[model samples]
Target: MSKQKTQPSMIGRMLRHLAGTHAVARRAFPSATLKAIQAGIGEGEKQHRAQVRMIVETSLSLGAVWRGESSRQRAHELFSRYRIWDTEENCGVLVYVNLADHKVEIVADRGVSRVVTRQQWQDVCRAMTAGYAHGAYHESTLQALEQLHVLLAGAMPRDSGDTAGANELSDKPLIL
Candidate 1:
């Protein structure tokens, strides 16, 4: 009898989610890395008025996986839940990393979407994912942040003496 390779079953996805615990997330993003990411976000914000938030999730909930929630969908949910879209210029960006699904999603607010093309955002995600595939998590994140900063600076440069456009979102990177 010949054995055929098939797509991963729902049970298999659930098992993958169960294996991707908080411990795995912690291992991937330790305290020092998180601090660096936070600092990177702050530095990036200084170059532009846009708010950048990074979220690294080890896995989706069993229910989420069962419902076939995509990484992009989860990223949009987080973007909303965390109020990334509430920035002054409406140029907030969310970088979501799902380890279990091996996916990277970049969700940009409408203001940014107007200036930055989807292909540009996808390129950023692909670069980050490439670094992640090689276990260069910290380096990859910082590089992606730099790329985002450039994009935001081009799209919405911080105006001189515009104090009202101050930091509107948390600088801390969320690990879930």
Candidate 2:
């Protein structure tokens, strides 16, 4: 018979950790901003799908595959830092939380470090530490995530909802 591995129980500890994370995320963002972020994510996805359709149309009109490929390359280069994906890669940090382990980690990319400054990170960390102590870290993390989403949404195209129809030609290829 094969032996089954059992997980350890830390229900009380997990609750305490979750409470702390919540507090920290909340402190990082405003309530209105959080709603906006959730809405933006939905809108952005719609826009991205339209942009893909635009590319398909543009490819056919431009003739040769090479031309289409070059255009795509140029488009990517032009908006590399102007979209959410680029923002995440270039100027964002990952906040990790482990309720079971009662641990929190924030990893920032080089771009984020360059733009946010050391003092800012320190301040955020200090606030998070306080939240952890008070069992509000979970909330704090949620707030921070909401704020980050809004910041990232700044990179989305202004008319992101306009989908590219089969017969329509994009004025500017919907760059970023």
Residue 67 displacement (Å), model 2? 54
Computed on alpha carbons, the lDDT of every model, listed in order, comes to: 0.88, 0.37
Report model 1's TM-score to 2 decimal places. 0.91
TM, every model: 0.91, 0.32
Q: Which stretches of candidate 1 lie over 4 Å from their true place?
A: 1-9, 163-165
What is the C-alpha lDDT profile of model 1 across 56-107, one tens digit per residue?
Answer: 9999998899888989999999999999999877888998999998899999
- The sequence of per-residue lDDT tens digits that candidate 2 reaches over residues 111-161 is 544545555544544555466666654465444444443443344323445
- Model 2's C-alpha root-mean-square deviation from the true structure amounts to 17.4
lDDT of 2 at 137: 42
The candidate that wins on TM-score is 1
lDDT of 1 at 108: 89
Please give the RMSD to the true structure for each candidate, in Å: 2.6, 17.4
